[model samples]
Target chain A: MEGNIYKKLLEELELGNKAVMITVMDDKECGEKNCNRKILYTEDNIANSCISDLNKVVYEKAKQSLETGNLEFVQVNETESYLIEPYFPEPRLIVFGGGHIAKPLVEFGARAGFLVTVIDDRPSFANTARFPGAEKVICESFDKCFDLINLNRSTFVVIVTRGHRHDMECLREVLKHDTAYVGMIGSKRRVKGAMEQLVNEGYSKKKLDKVNAPIGIEIGAVTPDEIAFSIIAQVIKYRRLADGKEEKKILSKVNWPEIDRDVLMELCEEDSLPKAIITIISTKGSVPRKAGAKMLVWSNGKVSGSIGGGCSEGEVIVKSRYLLRDREYEVHRVDMTAEVAEEEGMVCGGIMDVFLEPFWN
Target chain B: MEGNIYKKLLEELELGNKAVMITVMDDKECGEKNCNRKILYTEDNIANSCISDLNKVVYEKAKQSLETGNLEFVQVNETESYLIEPYFPEPRLIVFGGGHIAKPLVEFGARAGFLVTVIDDRPSFANTARFPGAEKVICESFDKCFDLINLNRSTFVVIVTRGHRHDMECLREVLKHDTAYVGMIGSKRRVKGAMEQLVNEGYSKKKLDKVNAPIGIEIGAVTPDEIAFSIIAQVIKYRRLADGKEEKKILSKVNWPEIDRDVLMELCEEDSLPKAIITIISTKGSVPRKAGAKMLVWSNGKVSGSIGGGCSEGEVIVKSRYLLRDREYEVHRVDMTAEVAEEEGMVCGGIMDVFLEPFWN
Candidate 1:
């Protein structure tokens, strides 16, 4: 039943639809069997409900969270609390060149959690060897490659092609897609020329003006790596800082690798090994991992994923093993408060509330 | 003879000594054989001299450059010009704990060209699997592990152990090393307590003030990765921004991966292959690679390293093939000046003076 909820949420994300995943945070008045229950709600309907009773209060909270794109821990009453998180499809980054700059750009882009795609007319430049971090590398002509890439509203386009002709071709096609960002790398003179040409070709000046010409923040970058760093920094600033004001919503919560798919898949498997799922429901101060980080602790002490990966994580694993044997849910508080931390062998001076739920298939 | 010069230079760098590598930039009055001829000059003596006639003028220039620690392209005369580059051992980043933050710290440190070493008492925490980017991972007690790591005056140390006890132990040992930078991860209260303890134990307040307590820059960082980024950014600022003023000289120049060891080792090998070495002696504006970027192109169209690696590099490769057969040197001018770049299929709006010389080894 839990697997079905996650499966439905993943499917909703895959379809470029918005969703709200509500996970019960506390056992409280609920029975041990109802502990850590979850519900997936989309715009159309309740995609999957792991909880037996989908209360009106929980449904209202999910709906409010979905509208505001907020992550909220809502306390309905003395007995119930839910962690409601709005989910959207991951943002996309499309590079129109796989040259020296593109190599580092793809690395920084992927590291920043954008699903990166590299496109170049030359196969040698547009190969996995050059851009190993890129999700897709398409060797296609510059003007005709738009059909190959998923140019959605949430996509960020960077044109760093070999010549002006290719840059113009990419810019023309990209303008029609209403991408979140369109940055073209070139000198001031080259950018001016490209803009003038596009304007003369009947493209609106206002649209052309929106492009991040000479792409990248002014960090006085000299090398390709530094330039790539500057560009990615600007991309992040745009995605995060322009939160509600921008038309393109900042989709996908959390950094890449924070959402451990392998652990989730293990949880989703049928009748798999007996394990305990540890989720950091809340955190305060300087913790290694934030709230929502999950880890899978098996019966034999083997583990997948991480909730900090230090003495704190080791403590969670120790607690999880006992919880797995008991086959119940427990909200364990991990105290790394500096004064007591040394005695407890914990480091990061923070406190975490972890929800440890025993699982079998 | 040229290979001997590079071999001796590498040896000096490996030994943590300072030296200067001077390469003749132009082939004017000097014969073709003298073009790109280099010399390795250490404090003791000239280690290797590829140029048969090392004039008094060049030696004086190298000595002056060594004193100022400057990278200079000096025009000795209308007939002779040389690019003088000082070589020092790579900066070392010693992370005291191979915990969650250390995972990203090693990566950022390595990327910033710091040779990183991670140490932890736990065998599970201190391993290659946890830190693939680190140069060394020593699994030993915090207090007893100093002998294993080379904590020289140029080393940057970060204390982030499993507890305050380990953090203090590491700090005590690290304080004796005269490291370039020392940072400790903790909350304000913990850092204050540790500092007070160290002061009571007889460490001077003047000395203790140097530590970057509460670690990282104030960027409102929360996650381990963000904190790691913040810490590494501070390290880089300490390195690149504080050049010349500090006692610990900013020694090794250029970013990591910019100096391709494979190409350099190949260049130093005895009659290994017939190839041409292309070095970007100077660049202006937004080019991919900076001055000193070297690439070796073989007769079989195989290439090692890169001088930008785009249309500009492709052009150089074609030029290198011609120069290889001719067995001569050419100071080729690559103009990617924006107006002319599009016509030539180049993108980066910069001009580069590349010294392409044929080699048989």
Candidate 2:
């Protein structure tokens, strides 16, 4: 029976299937007149022994088996013992660009243990000579290449094509799959435009939301290497999170209940007074408010702080609840000039970009 | 003078030199009349801040400067404080293999932000195609390539060559340089043969000792990916150790100096000892003693424990001092049947291995 079990486990492991093994030892066999010893093993050869005294013995055996890449079972009788192993498929990085940044990104991604594949419509850019470390280089349009590759949760798609339109084209295809990560490199304006286009094309809001537009953590990165650092950092963050490991830095700040409630209450109180509180969490281009700046709102809906504010606040307040609900905290550029910012009747002269996070109790 | 200093600092950073940034602030800058602030920023952009009442303001500015990758110096006499930016070069990984394992290792190394270079004798194996992720791939004999690469304290070298001979040849080259890590992959016999050859070659025992033969933590690795896992684990361990980070493993029994001494004394006192304690810290090949195993040496000097006693124990004991000095310990093997073992002792049959560590105090 032990031999049969061992053979079965070996088969599964060879086939790359995940499985666990259990062994039970009868009391008599355990040197305990009436007690039984039990052990469990995984296909990975991780073993757990129920008998504390037999732990060292079983652990050594398990380790030895693991070292030899073998799966086996030994009967201790009555007490159960077994091994468990989980098969993890290799991870792959599907890059949709072969530009300057893509060069280092691919090299780094490959070196980091991801089976990297670089794709470009231009044959010159997507050649083996150009991407020597890339596991595979495809000189085909993103649309056509998507069909040739198999993507899954372990697949990471980086859409860093030459332009926003190309980036969007790549993102549209990537979003259709269950990719572990989908990041597109673009300016804030370009990202917004691409997102709007995707949303208009009837892509599910949920899928659109999953895309990391203007990819990479906000590090004010300018150079290719610096940008690569930001992208890799974000990837590492996601990988850690997926593995249930603690991330070195908090990717997104938690929206404390009390803070959310307080901010909401303040906004509500000012509703009757015609004032607004403007909080800025981020900024881009020529924006007045820096990230994390806040302004108080007053009666008659006159705002003290800016979202970039002139005409941007009234609509902002309407959408603020959604941002609060979704926890989509980010910087917004609000036009304060009445002509540009005043869609309704109220116009603030100064432009302020506000990052309003809902304060809830 | 201040401008000159700032310019010099900027130049160093731009040239990718390593440096730390320090910032000092006065009371008013931190929003408190009497409060002061000081901050330190490392190359990785990890910041340590000291602030009083004006913590929020100072933190914001410090973070901004760090994000912008700017290093500077500023002074505010009365009302406000200034910020400083510093630049530091990233670390580099010097790999010695150009094999299948090197593929992922190089890829992962790049992704992890290491300046990676692959060195292999086979031009086909070391070319851009095989190691695209490698910033530079040197196609030269392993021994010759060492002359071209500069190995500093920060450089990490991983040896996963095609065979043991190549590994040994590469290791010898790296052993002469100041490196953060030197990991070699091989089986027990291969490792022993390589080491023996090195010892016979007149290489200083101390320098050769730094190599992590059978490199990687013993995690029961079998597959190439798993082997990669082990190698990476060792690399990470070395990196962390070099960075002064503490490993959290339970202290080894051998590491306990008092206990080791007690065991030695007890063995010495035994008029008719039944068992001798022989500790084998390392081993290679078809030897009776395995690394980390403890054996009992009989009173007749007839050993029951093996330390691959052949010729490895003397070195093991000398090296064990590292753990012993720190009051940290581990077990090792001593084989008494080999020529060296026979020359040194009164043996019992196959091999006489003993644990020479001190017993529990």
Q: lDDT scores for all predictions?
A: 0.72, 0.53
Cα error, residue B119 of model 1, in Å, equals: 1.9
TM-score of each: 0.56, 0.32
The residue-by-residue lDDT of candidate 1 on A261-318, one tens digit each, is: 6666676666567888887777887787776677999989999998887677788899
Can you give the lDDT of residue A329 in candidate 1? Answer: 70
Which digits, one per residue and each the tens of the lDDT, describe model 1 over residues B200-246?
99998977888889996544444576567567656665554333225
Q: For residue A28, give model 2's deviation from the true position in Å.
A: 18
In the range B1-361, model 2's lDDT, one tens digit per residue, is 1222324444444344333334344433333111323334433444443445334555555554433333333434554444443333345678887877887777666755567988877766788887777899998887778778877655778988877767777787777776667778887788888888888998887666677887865544433544554555455445433321122332111110001223233434424423323443333344553433444443334344334444555555554444333332233343433443332112333443233332221
At residue A228, what lDDT does model 2 achieve?
62
lDDT by residue for model 2 (A27-78), tens: 3333311122223355344544444645565566555543232333444433
